[model samples]
Target: MSARHIILCINVGSSSCKFALYSVSGGAESIVAEGVADRIGSSGGKIRVRDANGRSIAESDRDLARPQVAVDALFDEFERLKLPRLDVVGHRIVHGGAHHVAPEIVTPALIADLKRLIAFAPLHMPGGIEGVEAVAARHPKLPQVACFDTAFHRGMPERAERFPLPRELWDAGVRRYGFHGISYEYIMQALGADVPTRLIIAHLGNGASMAAVENGRPLDTTMGFTPAGGFMMGTRPGDLDPGVILYLLEQKGYDAAQLSRLVNLKSGLLGVSGLSSDVKTLLDARGSNANAAMAVEMFCYQIKKAIGALAAALGGLDMLVFTGGIGEHAAAVRAEACQGLAHLGLAIDPRRNDSNQDTISAADSRCRVRVIPTNENLMVARHAARLVFPAG
Candidate 1:
């Protein structure tokens, strides 16, 4: 009998830290426990933990004023619950930059490299780096691995990877490094033997992007250079014309910080609607609120346009996948996006789509459309297991 190894996967977001414990043994894996420390650095912060069976093991409001505090609370909950010892820790790192394309054991050198690349992902990298540091401070001896979200697209062709910039810029690592790679990888694994030759995955959520994959490999992706460069998101205006930025700098007198704040925080659905960034909230109010309606329409339009573009990139479409928060649950959004895509041989069965079925495409449609829930934490755990127990 093979010994079981416990792996803890950590994903640090802007205002939350989600974690899960997975037990892997003899080529099988199962969740042991999972939890989140949310509203960090804000009032009414809370941490909640639950067992594998969905029973609440611990839940309480605490002053999670910092990432360190959240990390401490998570460890405390584990100890209080008397959970199995963690053999390894894994992190979902947003950007691996030019190098670090694979999961690697955490080290001072790796930490230093990540810190340098923080400029590449200002809103995301800090939390990930802080998570690593916090884990090191609490349990220095435990091994931690980083699974990058950009690693899955590292194999993209140069035409897809390169920006239409000067040679110096491309040489300086200023090229397309798509995000949501961990989620895409998980979707591919979930597809298993059914994986198609031409695939397009639309990971729609607050931070949305699409990828064109050919025969289990990435050909191109919607996002470029940074997460903010994709389709419009919950709080971002993706793929703005350079002229707009130049005008903002020259005429509006906006500085780099101000531009970053505008594009990364103020824009997107929230900016357009002048309301909440939550898609459900906007969708519910779209009937009465014109701004809300426009926001939702714009989002769906972008999704539709990207589908066409990616299908062209792949020369054709075999399968289309919808994952992430909006992709999995928003039936209306899916319908609107695929409204006129029959030309691509894609047709959504209204009944199946409304019910949120796994395979929602019509039987006669040549392109198979699926809704597969993404498990990035599980992907992270698997990467950690591979790095830690290579033979297993």
Candidate 2:
């Protein structure tokens, strides 16, 4: 057995690839180096790698046409930097379908199973599979683990996970599969025994979702079936009426691809604002447009409604956790979501909220409002280490 082990955690997105290296010590893992490769395909930019302290160690510009070549360059960087052997590679797969309800060692069968879920997460799974395939080709013997973003919600009750549809659709597997499991799992792990019996965690980022977790297990989530199915996202429409899709198909003669593009790209904050999808920019505006303000208002309203629904699912809410980029930093958005939740005894102290404190809840608030940074990389590394170094 190796005395020292290194784990590489990879999260591959449509046009970006984020990598993190971790080392185990004192029965806990710590990140050593992490970076991202953005704009992988066309007009490729720089590859940035930095140490734990944010010290730049290696960086160079390159042009590429695909993720496979980009991932290959990452391996070359490892050699140039004299990085140690990677004991295991943990990948962030977007969809695992019904088969992978937990992390699994990467095998040919598992790969095939994951491939079948590509259509379910068209924009994400392809890049993720490309990264996995690239790594497998370069390092065949290295143990690899596939950690799913949907697996944490595997335990959702039939009622909560099921979509109200015909029996045939249900039988055909047309149901909700919540994502951002890695982040949700990290929050639960952070809570430990302190985790309340009923909890609602809001993961607000470019692609956002809220999960109803009871006793540290996922009971329901905001994003259902697909990433585009959740609350309004930076660029993706969420929870549109079925009639809208029908209108697009029948009236506009739009196909699946065109509809997908509309819902995933030309919608959300950008669509509403006709400005930018970024929340920070909207917040900084001197004068507000009706559409932008309406978009922001609608966004918060949707989140509040989701929280209420999840609270109902959990019977009651005890812990309300906020994670991800927007969740952690968007004080105004958080306040708006908790506005009418005073009935649930959820109140945020204006001063604390503005300071971006972890605990923003008022002293008398019943619910504990905490802002926890999502460490998906560390979570993936831990899961990979458990599989690669499992004790007999």
Candidate 3:
């Protein structure tokens, strides 16, 4: 366990297998290689592989119509590079359900248990589970770890985790289990003790959510029961009223599956703007399209509202960190979000925001705001190595 070991961390994106090879030794890690097999299940699949120096060594197009196919393509590319022998594998498992609150060794029994929770995270689990199984099948004896995205929020109080549903439903595992643990873990590690005691992390991507943390521990998060419950995503409605759901099914004669698709796929900014889900596209069209302008306004409005609500939950916000796709580069969105939040002593410096500094808030701003990129793949690798080779 003390010797240098190579770990491959596979993060199962919606349509890609993102992997990074890390060399871990003496309690430190260095990147060995990284890249992705993208466009899975599509005809125009692409693969890109890079070496430790961050240079692309292999790039090609192939049929990545399945997880196995995509993974196999990655391996074929890696073979030419002749990387170190893999010691173990780590998977970015999105939902671990009730049983796993930390990184766990992957086993057949555990896989079975994990698949049972797929219905809870329908959009995320199937693809992730497929990637995990495909890797295990390829290397039967290779030690593997399942790092749960829900593990970070497991420490949240019952009051925060529980829904107001019936006791029976709660017992049946219908409760809030926030995601993005891997990203939050890396962010906390990077921030170290300098991180404020009360903090909020806004991970704004196509699939977005926010986390309220106290002393580096998650207290509450926007996502609940499923990823679909969180903030308005690219295509999913956030925090919808139950009455609307009942109305959709009972009055409109929509079935359960159809209702699920409505919220999970056809709603959100796409539904409102009748255009692309990408925020940049919406921003570009805002000047010309009324619907796109309204969509942008709503998106920022929702983020501002969530910041206020989370600040209230934390008693007050000391530091606000933004990550993910939209949180990192969308300065206009950031400005729009912080426009009315100056009342909370959160001021966005226009120059700093535009420049993309690590700290985007004004020097005198009471609540500091930062832009810290997330490294969930590295988090997965660390977790996998720890579980694969436990401390004495």
Candidate 4:
């Protein structure tokens, strides 16, 4: 057996593709290189490939009409690098439906099944499928593994996973399928035994969600069945009452396509503030702009409510972890979310929270609040390595 194995972790978004290469020796893995192809299929499409030390390896901006075009460009860079014999390609797939509760080697049949799931999460699945297909076409001989974002929540109890819809709908597989499981998995791995039994992890980013984890298993999550349903995000509304959708369709003159665009693209922070969807921009403007203040308030309010709900789900909260972009860096948001949750025994140490620390909980707080930077790609690489070589 070879001493070194290369694992390529691919995370494809709606108009972007991020990949990281890792080298595994024995049981340890190290990041070899990583970068992203963004604004895909547009005239302004650009890509940047960087080494592990944050130095640029390759960069480009060229007109394109599809993500595959950008992906093909990536393949060109790979050939130039000629890194090593690739052992496995691990893909980040958003939804696995009721099937695919674990990592599985890619096959045509598996691809077909995943394609059928596109309607469930139309915004995300297509890009992931496109990335997987591109890899299949470019390097058909190499073994590929798919790591699911929903697979981590596979152990959720029947009640938690079931929607209140009719029994027929349940039989037809219409139930809650929480997303962002890979990131959550990484947090659990990063926390290990130090992370108390009952935990609540808030993954705040462009697409945000909160999870109730008891003994390292998911009991419930804020985002149910789709990425758009969760805490308000950069551009996506968190949970909306079913009546809102009905009213929009009947009285607000909204077609399915229009509603999709509004809910998934034009809403959230942008809609709330009537400004940019970026958190940094909102944070800067919140003090002076009423709309920005409201947006920030709404975002924190939703997160606080979710934390309370998850605390109830876990019977009690022990460890509260913050990850992702806003969760890791946005101290104000974290502070705001924990403001009214003191009754739940959660409090953030202002100094530790402001500074970059592993645990941000105050000494007197009953719950251990943490700030853990998640590594979804590393989680994918580790899962892929184990799947490809169960015993090494």
- Candidate 2: residue 303 lDDT (0-100): 89
lDDT by residue for model 2 over 1-392, one digit each (tens)?
43567999999888888999988744577778989887887684668899989999998987756778778888888889988788899999999887688888999988887788787888899999999999999999988999999899989999877899998987777889999999998988887778898899999998899998787777889888899997898899889999999999999999999998999998988888887788888766615577778778877888899999889888888989999999999999999989999777798889988888989999999998998888998898888878878750
Best of the two (1, 4) by lDDT: 1
- lDDT of the candidates, in the order given: 0.94, 0.87, 0.88, 0.89
- On TM-score, the stronger of 2 and 3 is 2
Q: What does candidate 3's lDDT look like per residue over 1-392, in tens digits?
A: 56888999998867888999999986799998899999998889999888889998888989998888888777777776788889999999999887799999988999999889988888788888888788777788988899999999999999999999899998999999998878888888889987898999999888888999998788889999887887788998888999999998889999988988888888889989999789999999999999999988998999999999989999998999999999999999888988988878899889999988999999999999999988898898888877777761
Superposing every Cα of model 2 onto the true structure, what RMSD results? 1.6
Q: Write the per-residue lDDT of candidate 4 for residues 57-114, one digit (tens) a residue.
A: 8888865467677678877887787766677899999999988899899999999999
Model 3 spans with C-alpha error above 4 angstroms: none
Off by over 4 Å in 1: none
lDDT of 1 at 109: 96
Per-candidate TM equals: 0.98, 0.97, 0.95, 0.97
TM-score of 4: 0.97
Error of 1 at 330 (Å): 0.4
Model 1 backbone overlap count:
0
Q: Name the candidate that leads on lDDT.
A: 1
State the RMSD for candidate 1: 1.1
Instruction: In model 2, state the lDDT of residue 143.
Output: 87
